[model samples]
Target: MGQLSRPIPLLLLFGVLVLAGCGALGPGFFADRSPRERVLLLDTPFYAQEDYQCGPAALAMLLAWNDEALSLPALSDQVYSPSLEGSLQPAMVAAARRHGYLVYPLDQPAALFAELAAGHPVLVLQNLGFSRLPRWHYAVVIGHDLARNRIFLHSGRQQAMEISARLFERTWARGGHWGVVVLPPDRLPATAGETPFLAAAAGLEQAGQWSAALLAYQAALERWPGSFGARVGLGNARYALADYELAQRAFRQALLLQPANGAVLNNLALALAAAGQRQEALVVIRQALELDGIWRQELLRTRQKIIADQP
Candidate 1:
C-alpha cells in the first residue's frame, strides 16, 4: 500500500532456544485468575516462515483468518526486508491495512487472551532468547488454555506449538509485549478502549482509507456513543469522502458531548462551509474563536474564509 519503504530490523524467524520441555502445567506457573477459567482454541490457518519471513507468515495467517487470502510470497514482497533479513512492524501493519483489514494492538498479555476468547488470532512479537542476546520472532497466538496453563501458537515451523503461559509472558515482555489482531473494519476487538480504538481508526484515515476509516469509526461509536474522538473521527472520514451533510451530523454529535471543545467546533464549522452553509459556518467559527483550544488559530482562518466568501 506504499505505507512504508524503509527496512526495519525488528522481527525475524530464526534459531530460538527451544526449552527442553513445557514447564509445569499448574496454577503456580503464573498467578493470575479472572472470574472463570475457559479454554478457547481458534481454527487459525498456519503458514510457516521460510528463513526470516516470520513477519509475512504471521501477517498472512492473520489475513487468512479474516478471510482476506493473500499469498506468502506477495506478503513477503510487501513487508519483508531482504537486507535486514526480517520485516518491520510498520510494514506488517501497513500490509494488513492495504488489504482492508484493521490491525489493533493487544497492548498487554491480558489483551491477547481477550482477543483469543473473542475468537480472534493475535500476531505477536517475541524475544525467544534472553534480553541481552535477543532472538526476535513473530508468531500468531491461536488459543489459550487456562486450565492447562498453556498458550497455543502457530509459530515458526510449528503448527500447534504449545508453550507454558509463564514462558510466553517472559518472552512477550522481553519483546515489549507487542501484539496485534487483524480483522475487518466492522469488527471491534473484545478489549478495545475508546481512545485506542479511535486512534486505530484514525490510522486508517491517516492512511487515506476513508471508507474503511468510516466503518471503523462507526464501530467505535456503536461501542462508545459518547466518545468525542470517535465522533470527530467519523466526521473527518465523512468529510474526506465529500459527504458533507453526514460529516456535519457527526461533528454535531461531538459538539453535544463537549460543547466548548474548540477542535470539534472548528470541524463543525468546516463541514458547514463545505455544505455551502456560509452564514452558519461563520457563526460556528466565531463561537469556536471565542472559546480557547488548540484549534483557535485554525478557527480564525476559518472565519476569514467564510467572511471572504460573502457577496
Candidate 2:
C-alpha cells in the first residue's frame, strides 16, 4: 500500500490525541477564537464542571470544577475579602453553599502553586501568584495549553491572555507565597449588616465598578465611622480601584478602631504590597493571621510571597 493511502496508523494517532486530558481537545482549528470567548472559556461554559471559572455566568461550570481540597484566598480587592477572616475553610464552605462552589485557599500561595504544579486545580487570589502584575487582580484557570506551555485563565479584567504555561508554573511556584485564605464551599457571615455590604461590594468589584462601591462604603462610614464593616468595605473598594494609598489609609483607619482585626490587617498588608512594601505587607498579614486562629493556615502562603519578593 502507498504511504499516502495508509489509514491505520493515522487512526491510532487520532485516538491518542482524543484521549488527551480525558478527551480534552485543544482549540485545534478554533485556536484563533475571539478574545472575549477565550477569556471566558470554562469546562462547561456556564454549566458545572471540575474546572476554574468566573462568577455567575460561570457558576455551574465552577461548581463542577470545585476542588474540595482546593481553596482560595480573598481578593483583598474582592468586597467579600472582609468576610474571609476567621476560619478560611468554613468561610469558603459557607460561600460555596450559596455560590455553588467554594473558593479554596491554601495556607500559603507557594504551597497552592506547588499543588497546582502537581496537577491540582485551585482558586488563587491575585497577590498570591503573579505578584508583580497589579493590585486588585483576580482570575481563574479553566484550561491550559500544556503542549504549547501555556496557562488558560479567566482574568478579572475580563480579558483572556494565553500566558506561557511554563511562565505561569514557574511564576506561580515562586510567588504563591504571599498569603492565602482556604475557602470552604460554605462561608456564611454570622453577623447582621455584614451580608449586605459584602454582597454589594462583591457585585461592584465583579462588575469593575469600584468607584461606586467605594463611595457607597464612604456614605456608610459617615453614618458610622466606627463600623468595622463599613471600613473593611471602603478598604477593599479602594484597593479594587487601585487607590493603593487610599486603600492603606482606609485599612489603617479601620485597624485603629478595630486593632488586631484580621480583615483590616491582612487588607492593610494587601495595600502595602500594592504600594511596593511587600515586607510590610507580610508583617501586617502575619499579625492578621495571628489575631484570628482560623487564619493560621494562611501563614505559609503569606510568608512565601514575602520571601520571593525579597532581593
Candidate 3:
C-alpha cells in the first residue's frame, strides 16, 4: 500500500458516504434476500500479468453465468488491482502494461478500495489482496456479500479459500458474488501498446476523475466512433459520473456493433436505472438475464432486484 494519494478525495468521500449510513453494496432494504443466498464467482488472481487467462476467463464466466455469453469485452481499458509478493512482485504499472490492462498506479490500499467502489476488479501479481491464502493462489471477483462485507472469493489453491465477500472488502469496498473462476485456455494478447487514451482514462478514473475519462472517451470516439473499446469505456465513465443518459447511449452504441452482448446490456441497464428509467432498465436487464440463461445466479439477482423495485 503506497501513497493512496490518487484516491485521497474518493477515499474521503467513500468513508463519509458509508459512515453517513448510505446502505452498503447489496440487494435493497425491501428485498428479503439474505446473505445465505448464493452469488456468482470468477477465479482470477489479484495481480496476474500476460499469462492471466484466469482473469479474462472469469469475466467470460460471469457473462455465461448470466446466460449471456460473448467474446470478452475489449478489456483494453478496464482496470484491475493486484496483490503481489516476493521477487515476483513487479510494479502494477508494469504488470498492467504487460497484460494490456490499465493500471491506476495508486500504491495506497485505500485507493484500491476506491477503484472497487467504481465497479472494476483488481488483480494480484504476487500475493496481495488476500492477507493470507490457505494455500497460495490468485482470485477473480464475481460478486459481493454486503452483509458479511467480504468479496465472496475463490481461487486455484489446493483447497481454495472460499469465504465471505466482506473478507476481501478490507481493501475492497464494492463487490458482489465472487468465487468459482471458470476458465478456458489462454486468451487475450499478453501485451500491447498502452494507448495514450487508455493511460489517460485509467488515471482519470482512478482519481475519481470520471468527467475527464468521459471526455477523453468522447474524444477518442470522435476519432474512432465504432470503437467498441472507446464506446464501452465511455459508457462506464459516464455511469461513474451519474450521467446515465449518455452512459446508456454509449453502451447502446457498443451493442449496435456487437448485438446481444450481455455485458453491454447489463451495464446499459444500470445506466438506465441511474437515469430514473427503472422499468426500462429492468426490461433490458431481464433480456440479458435470459441470454445468460435461467441458471445464471448473478443476473438472477440483478433481475430479481429490478423486478422487486418495480412500481
Candidate 4:
C-alpha cells in the first residue's frame, strides 16, 4: 500500500482538476430533501485503517456487517496490490465474489442513501484533497443525517467521521461516485434496479454456484416477476442443480414473457430432453432454431442431443 505521507501523484491531480471544472455532480436526487428529514445509522463495526489499507478495512467492515466477519489481512491478500500499493477495483469485486456475496455497483448518488436506509453499509472511493493535490481514499458510509447535511463514514484513523455532504460529494465525484455493496444470495439491494441486479445474480450462476445463484435469481424474480432475464437465470440454476421440472417451468415462464426469445426456448428444450420428453424437446428446439440469432448454434446442439437420446 502507498504511504499516507506521500504526495498526490500528478495524474490523480489532473483527474481531480477535470472533475472540479465539470461543476457539482449534478443536483443529486436527495438534494431536495428537507433538512428535518429522518436520520439513519446502521450499527456497523468499525476498523481503523493502517495506512493505505482503507480498501481492505472498508471491505472488512461491510463483510462483518453482512455477517461474513472476514479478517482485514486475509482480505488484503485478495484485493491488495503489492506493486501498485493499493487495491484494484476488479480485485475487490472478485474478492467479494470469492466470499459468496454478489457485488453490484451503485451508479446513482442517491442509491447510496437508499442502501443506508436499508441498513447496508456502502464502500465508496473519495478524493480528500483539492483539485491540485488529491488524496485518494476508500471509506465505508454507514449513516446519514439529512437534517445536518452530513454523512457518517468509517474513514482513515477515525472510526466515525462526519463529513459535510457537499465535501463528500465533491470527493466522491472525483472517483466517479464509485460505490459497491456485497449482498447475500437471498437478499437484493434496496436501491438496485432489475437489470443490474439480474446481472449480478447471473454472475453467480456463471461461477457455478448453483444453489446460491438460484436463491439470487429467486430474489430477483420476487422483485420483478416479469423479468425474462431473471426467469432464464432461474431456469439455468435449476437445470444445473438437476431440477429439470422446475427448470422447464422457469424457462417456459420466461418464454411466456418473451415468446420469441431463442435462448429461453433452447433452455426449455434442454430441460424437456433431460426430463425424458425427447419428442417434445425436438419440437421446442426446432422453434428455438427458427427464431435463433446468436443462440442458433446452441439450439442446434440441443436438437442434436434430443435426437441422439431418442429411444
For model 4, the local distance difference test gives 0.73
Pairs clashing in candidate 1? none
Reference-based lDDT, residue 226, model 2: 73
What would the per-residue lDDT of candidate 1 be over residues 23-86, giving only the tens digit for each residue?
3224544455351265445578888889998889988998888778677788899999999888
Mind giving the per-residue lDDT tens digits that candidate 2 earns over 122-186?
44333334446523223455445434646565554343457764445444444332222222212
lDDT measured at residue 82 in model 1 versus the true structure, 0 to 100: 91
**How far out, in Å, is residue 49 in model 1?**
0.8
TM-scores for all predictions: 0.84, 0.36, 0.37, 0.82
- Which model scores highest in TM-score? 1
* Predicted model with the maximum lDDT: 1
Instruction: Show model 3 residue runs off by greater than 4 Å.
Output: 1-207, 293-295
Candidate 3 displacement at residue 109 in angstroms = 33
For model 2, the superposed segments whose C-alpha errors exceed 4 Å read 1-198
- Estimate the Cα RMSD of every predicted model relative to the unseen true structure: 8.3, 24.2, 20.5, 10.4
- Residue-level error in angstroms, candidate 1, position 239: 1.0
Candidates, ranked, TM-score: 1, 4, 3, 2
Cα misplacement distance, residue 276 of candidate 1 (Å): 1.9
